[model samples]
Target: MAKPCGVCAGVRRAVETIERALVVYGPPVYARHEIIHDRHAVDELQARGAVFVDDLSAVPDGAVVVFGAHGVAEEAEHDCERRGHDVIDATCPLVLKLHKEARRLADRGYDVVVVGRAGDDEVDAIASRIPGRVHVVSHLADVERLEVADPARVAYLLQTTLGGLDTVDIVAALKHRFPRLATQDGDACSAVHDRERAALKLARRVDAVFVVGSGSAVTTRRLLEIVAASGVPTRLVENAGAIEHGNIDGLTAVGLAAGPSTPDKLVDAVVARLKMLRPVEIDVLDGVEEFVRFRLPSRLRHAGERSSPGLGGAPLAPGAALSHDR
Candidate 1:
């Protein structure tokens, strides 16, 4: 049996809340980017009448646009204002905290090095927040390319969803180059750390580990990397169909986990396939449990204020607690 990953479960719950509210409120709920980076989640929302758009231009003038969980660049927020689209920012608060931290570090005259996928919406915002002060690096080797005015004055910030062990090694390499380089506390989200730890633990108990996640999900890629780094046989599959018969022919134990953005249903399908294949025991390794909850935007909190009527309805209130579907 496949269990829901904490992070994906939380996001799934959040998406359900928004969809239900839209039902009470009407249609054309324009979402900026995949709501949680899961194709299944996006497809489900689309079936329920949510329109996912990559660019703000797809949204008509005065339409309501909801931001995805990964968060958007400040420029995107400004564009929404300029375009007159009613904005509902669903950026995970943990990511927002990192963006703010990166900006704060940049403002203090320190050069910043951001470690993450280049051109990612979140990375772009972190770079934009500091402009000239920030440089992006995806691999550990790229750390040598940092062009800082003073190595001593440089600080490193991470994409909140990056792999935990990978960041440790990357940061170690950077510190070797610049011993005096500053760093922030708890940059990666607790959820990412917890899931990575869970994967590692599960890896020890199984002959092979299968990480179910979308092809483009950054965190999912990291999970695969982490498992492979342990020298265990690991496969990263987008769905159960990718699971070849030969891969699981003789494995007595198999470990299963999904990245933060994956859907619970896809993971379940994978587990079901494994169950049918043989008598292997499925296990969930004990790992960190996170209790963090992100507050919804003001519009989603209160009943009196409706999300602007034209797009769908009026905005939700600031302090409203969304219903949890999981």
Candidate 2:
């Protein structure tokens, strides 16, 4: 079997950890969205009694809900508290860092332009905090006529999953227009940046590269651009089913990679589909490995002290509700 991408492997491990701690009860363990944008992963969880809902109203009162990798807005958090629901925040730490950065920039009087797809939850949260001060940009040209209250005080924040090279081009355009714009120290997640780099390494050795991820995923789209920059043929597909055999016709060697939120099964499916077209040799390209891990909520660690039960299962201890604030 071919090796899985590091991000996909990490996400799978995280979900498994949560699964082991689950306790069946009211509403069947509600999740706010597709846990990690991988249909196979989400479907597997659904089969295991996990219920996915997009809106708060869909969750019954007092249900234990888990937030997806995409962090929910403060308003969503407030709603859960008001409804007396137990909440487990499963947002990736990198995304949380981006949210905090956006809030800090806006608070410092910067006209923040949160750029990504229009409907993505990450973009929505940043937009909600500073409505008038926030501007949304999708492409490099979108920055051409950016209308900020103060051009000199403009700043930019990106969705953690954005393509690396695409962000560079946008930042370059923004600098050309407003020379004084500031950005966070690290604009994109390390996993995304490293995966794009790995894809490029393979692209140079092959004529084409295939990126497996959902169409709406930002990181997967970026991998295509990174490969195309080297003048190689590249295709971005959600899974093996979307791969058009005609596109890779006559290509000697092909590179394979997936987005941070993609699952191993989808990558394997792509490898199997490609085999039907040609006897392709799979090269496991090496790149950076992420060792990042986030701590469970404090209340979960000391459940006995919680006055009320928390997410997944009962609080780690009784009368431990105070630690849930973290």
Candidate 3:
């Protein structure tokens, strides 16, 4: 049975910030990356005058630019500042917190180990912020190859979207090698923990599993791996259109989940498509109920407040609401 699981608070905040930016700044607003990794969200923003570019060089001088939810390298931020671009930071606050922790660990003279996929945008950003002291490791093998100044003077930071089970093994490996190693104050963001736990529980009870999210999204890929590890057949799709009927044939019951960047509409579309594929009864697999809401950047918040009809007497665009919800 399909369930209602998609779009965490951070992702929802990023999208809404971009939408409000469009409403306030008009056309040609620039985004440094695919605002969140989901194609549907990127396409929708592009259709509404959000121009996404890889490098700051692609954006015009003095234009308003938004950093993506995954965050960006320090060099990218310097470039934006050097180019005189009016920047609206849409980086998720949890990721910002991770970056701060990485810098603090490095400043404390600890050889920092970032436990995540090398070259992932978030991982790169976190590592880049710590300069010469950061090392990235995906598994125990990577940890075995790590060379540091002192085994006792080491600290580790986790990528916010990594699965909890995978993190456990990696953390254990780090601790085994460096008995004095330090870690972040808590587990990865609560959103990551909740979604992964729910997905695993749902995957265990189903004949097959379908994950709705972009292939490039790390969280979605992690979800796919975790579910598949449970011995359940699983597939990762961008949307309902990508589902192949033959692959799901003869399945009596199926489970559905989506990544943090996935929109609710995609989940609904996949659920509707599943019903058309076979006469299956749909049910919601209850999981953790998320209620976290990240505040928008100051610029967007001020603009939204002024643009509200009741506040400044200026009418907002139709369908635009000032509230932030997950």
Candidate 4:
């Protein structure tokens, strides 16, 4: 097993927020987006009366709503207020940090450029706040095509999820193209780098590596890319049941990793299933255990955790609702 597995600190806080909100308020606690981009997590919450909607308008007036871990555009936050929704912002703190940088750069009269996948939710949120030209670049090839009005007065921000993970080379390319490019450079948190490094290392020792996470999650896809690039046989599975597709019946050694947005219960389920397939001993690599956590809405009081009648239940609690004005 790879170290630093299971949900990251930011994701944990977001999942907990929704779970607690459902408890504090009762049936039909609304969420602005799929919290954490994991299907199992969202489905479990939904069964417990967590209603997810892409638009704030879909939620009833004054209803309790929570934002996803990836965060949302500044305009969406305003929409929640305008619609009189008791909104709970479950945005990951790391994403919130990038949003702050975006606003700051735009305020300083610089064209904000973001290096990430164009249509990603995180990138979209960052771009929506900038009032000026906001260019999205992915590869080095995209750099030359950029036609910013003011190259000398350009600042670039990175999408906080997997897109920004280990993108120093891309940042360097942007700096070279835009002579006066401003950046807080290499600002991705240490945990992000650590997790990637751990996965890569695990890939080398094992003949095959199975990453357990949602297919839609940014972290899961990035981890798959990193492991696959290491010249080791790698496959992504949503849970242990998908492990058979890795074709690992004859592998001498195997590595397991869970994406940051995945729940430990799912990982545990995977491990239990893996053990049932064959006799194996569990081992964990040495790495930093992250303890970072962000603040939740003031109304989200941690009363206690109890089973919420979801498939493979999780700790659920009840709490208060928050209006933006409060």
Would you list the C-alpha lDDT of every candidate in the order shown?
A: 0.70, 0.67, 0.77, 0.75
Which is the winner by lDDT between candidate 3 and candidate 4? Answer: 3
- Top lDDT model: 3
User: Which parts of model 3 are misplaced by more than 4 Å?
Assistant: 1-4, 242-250, 275-281, 303-326
Model 2 agreement with the true structure over 1-326: per-residue lDDT tens digits: 11235244224433643454364343378877666666666676777778878798899998888776666777898999999888777666666677778878888899988877777777776676664488888888899878888889999887766666657888788989989988876646656667777777777777777777776655666666677887877777776877777878787777787767676567777888888877877778666644443444443444222211111112223342221122
Displacement of the residue 14 alpha carbon in candidate 4, Å? 1.1
- Mind giving the per-residue lDDT tens digits that candidate 4 earns over 62-164? 8988887777777888888898888788777777778778888888888888877787777888889887778888887888888877778998877666433
Give candidate 4's whole-model lDDT: 0.75
Tell me the TM-score of each prediction against the true structure.
0.81, 0.74, 0.85, 0.85
Provide the lowest-lDDT 10-residue window in model 2.
304-313
In model 4, the clashing pairs are 23-317, 23-318, 24-318, 24-319
Candidate scoring better on TM-score of 2 and 3: 3
lDDT for model 3 = 0.77
State how far residue 199 of model 3 sits from its true place (Å).
2.0
Which candidate do you rate higher for lDDT, 2 or 4?
4
Clashes of each: 13, 16, 0, 4
Q: Report residue 233 deviation for candidate 3 (angstroms).
A: 2.7
Model 3 quality (TM-score): 0.85
